[model samples]
Target: MSPPPEHRRAPPPTDAETLCRTGRKVIATEAGAVAALASRIDAGFVAACQTMLACRGRVVVTGMGKSGHIAGKIAATLASTGTPAFFVHPGEASHGDLGMITREDVVLALSHSGESVEILTILPLLKRLGVPLIAMTGQPASTLARQADAHLHTGVAEEACPLGLAPTSSTTAALAMGDALAVALLEARGFTEEDFAFSHPGGSLGRRLLVRVRDIMHTGAEIPWVPEHALVLDAVLEMTAKNLGMTAIVDAGQRVLGIFTDGDLRRLLEKAGDIHAVPVAAAMTRTCTRVTADRLAAETVRIMEGKRINALLVVDAAGRLIGALNMHDLLRAGVL
Candidate 1:
């Protein structure tokens, strides 16, 4: 007899469906983990936070395999959010990277099972170094947990993985718990946006948070200015020479009284008068918006946008002209 006719089966799903299903399951599992954590917060959680805040040195986070990756991210988040933290692979720490740690530091170890061999291998050395240990593990009674100075229960109900072998739900729980710790400490220390800016000095947030108007505003010779009594023609010359599109009209005390912009010049030109003979003050916007040089550039952007203007004169508390900034300055400063 001929071989049985081959039975054809339907092809597997497209990549998009698979990813969608996986993402939904992961999100559901993580939500459940966060829900579980709410009830579990107790004395131990407080102790863990206290241990981290009390440490004089950096927080050295460590883990093995997949947990190590999560540990690295946790360390980065902590470091960027005002906490000084760095990751050390458990395997590497056992070999020699343990020297990077000190008694003044705190060790945050991550393991889903709470029995990672590489992590356990260094427990004794960490103990010898007298470093406070904060354990993030699914099993509260596991060896790592028992040896820790503070054990944070990252126990998840189950993994999002169908086979329940991958470190899915557990890692999510651990990462959330790490964020909780970092944020708690961040709040406890009264850390501000300026502090965050220091850590992220090269990023967009740094520019927005740390850059003040004085840092980029045109001051001294760069400022386009003319006396209040100066004619419109002189104001135009000053504006053109400084290339700021506007000129500040100030009194003899250098206190800003008004501003004359290209728009104002246009309006003045439409009037039936001698532009050359008219004082610049007559064409200037007297109730002009102004900002202090010490104000944040980001705030200045908001003020400018809200006022529907392109330039502003930076002045002191007594209204003395100190500097000037335009939309182009904000654009160059990455605050626009």
Candidate 2:
């Protein structure tokens, strides 16, 4: 038997060598790409922004393969950040999706080489429709670049891929550049959190940013409350019925006087008194944290977290109890 094929283990790299070689190469490549972009921010970039801003229709982004994936993400980011945008695969655009593009819209095409045949095939039709073109590519002199109304160069010194055959560093640079453009436009248009929430109504950010306290609070008969003169047993029943771990103690006018919680019940049980005979008001916490109905659900979360409490009473400007919420409500609403 040929001496059992000798086993070899990869050598460990020294820290300084790793930093000086691999780390430095990546940093240098990305830095060079970003630095090159600074001077390249010419009239073309401004023209691209202006065209997109002036568009009466949506921004149509198109690319092929890896560029297509990046284009899809860029479209989503733009759409959520105040710009109405969507992605169209260059191959599909050449087929029938080209109908999606309108004369009033702007087209953003992506290709590292700027020579993707799929993308190039649709250029003529876009031009015929009078759609302004913004090309993002590594080759500034390629066909797409030459044909575009604006060319955003995304050239890098070298790719992070070991074989330099993959679209690793180039894709990252393109994604970052796309983010820069989206954020710039978002800020220019004074896009607010509410605007972002409208685009992402199904997400946690939307719940936290757009949901108001009143929307989630238990109101009307759902609120677990008892008169200040109610027996401790009545408060316990109210807390148990509501399952909120607490009950609000209110006066006759529905103004919150104090809050009686499971903690108060526990402490009260240890005292030399009958649970049924004690007035809940005597055992309630007088200084409970309260919020307004108009407050953001996110703010309510912050107040609860900061105060180390699980529930809050919603009050009006005059301090009358309007609603109540527990941590469970926030969690269920996707605001936590």
Candidate 3:
């Protein structure tokens, strides 16, 4: 199956020291390229941001080859950080996908050479639509850069590739510029943690911010509790039945008066031995922390961890017990 010896030749034996030096050289070169992009974020960068911010429609990001990968990531970051954006391949744009572009949309085109044939092919169409164009390219004098409303120069002294052919430093610079643009737009719109969580609803930050205590707390019969005058034995039975490792001591009207925990039970057994006759209220912690049903579960975790407690009782505005939750509940709900 092998056609040519030149194409089938194997690589030389590895040199660990040379490989390490090469890795460091690549990282240093890429870092320098990214750092250089910061200085170029002047008027053109501001103009690009202004254009995107003024657009009523989404940002349409287009690129070819290696630039396309960076464009997709930039699009995702933009979309998640409050700027609506999506990626469109330059090649596909020439094949009827150009219809996706509209005057309402802001076009962000990425091409190191600034003369991608596919992108240049649709440049006229974009102009015809009167859409604002923001070109990210290495060549300031290239056609794409000259025709755009704003040009972000991503030029580097040299690529990290020793052969000076592959897109190592150029892609790094482009990615850094993309991140800077996304963050600038995010701040301009005053995007908050809650807003970010809304876009990442499946992530841990979403769970912590959006999940309320009431959503995960045990309710009705599932909540472990014993009457204020109930025997310690009864409280132990309730804790075992609920498996919450603790039980609330409440009055007949369901107002939480105190809490009896596994730790309290252990301490009581060591001190008074026979809890078979002891009142639950006498053995309960009178200063136990309780929260309202509507509080955030994340807030409850902080309270529990700070106070060195495991369980908490949930009450209404009138101080009547309505629900209960422990560390285990929060953990299960991904709020831990």
- TM-score of candidate 2 versus the correct structure, residues matched by position: 0.87
- Per model, state how many residue pairs clash: 0, 0, 0
Question: Candidate 3 on 93-194: residue-level lDDT in tens?
Answer: 888888888789999999999999999999888998999999999999999999999999999999999899999999999999999999999999999988
Better of 2 and 3 by lDDT: 3
Q: What is the C-alpha lDDT of each candidate?
A: 0.91, 0.89, 0.94
Candidate 2 residues 236-335, lDDT tens each?
A: 9999998999999988898999999888899998983578788887899999999999999999899999999999899999889999999999999999
Would you list the rank order by TM-score, best first?
Answer: 3, 1, 2
Error of 2 at 252 (Å): 1.5
Q: How does candidate 3 score on lDDT?
A: 0.94
* TM-score of candidate 3 on Cα atoms, chains taken together: 0.94
> After TM-score superposition, what is the CA distance of residue 105 in candidate 3 from its true location, in Å?
0.5
Q: State the RMSD for candidate 1.
A: 2.7
- Write model 1 residue lDDT over 1-336, tens digit each, in one string: 655557556677779989899889889987897889887788889999899888899999999888999999999999988789999988888678989998899999999889999999998888888899999898999999999989999998898888889988888888888898889889999999999999988888999999999999998899999998899999999999999889999999999999999999888888845687888888899999999988999998989999999998999999999999899998998876
> Residue 74 of candidate 1: its Cα lDDT?
96
Q: lDDT (0-100) at residue 265 of candidate 2?
A: 90
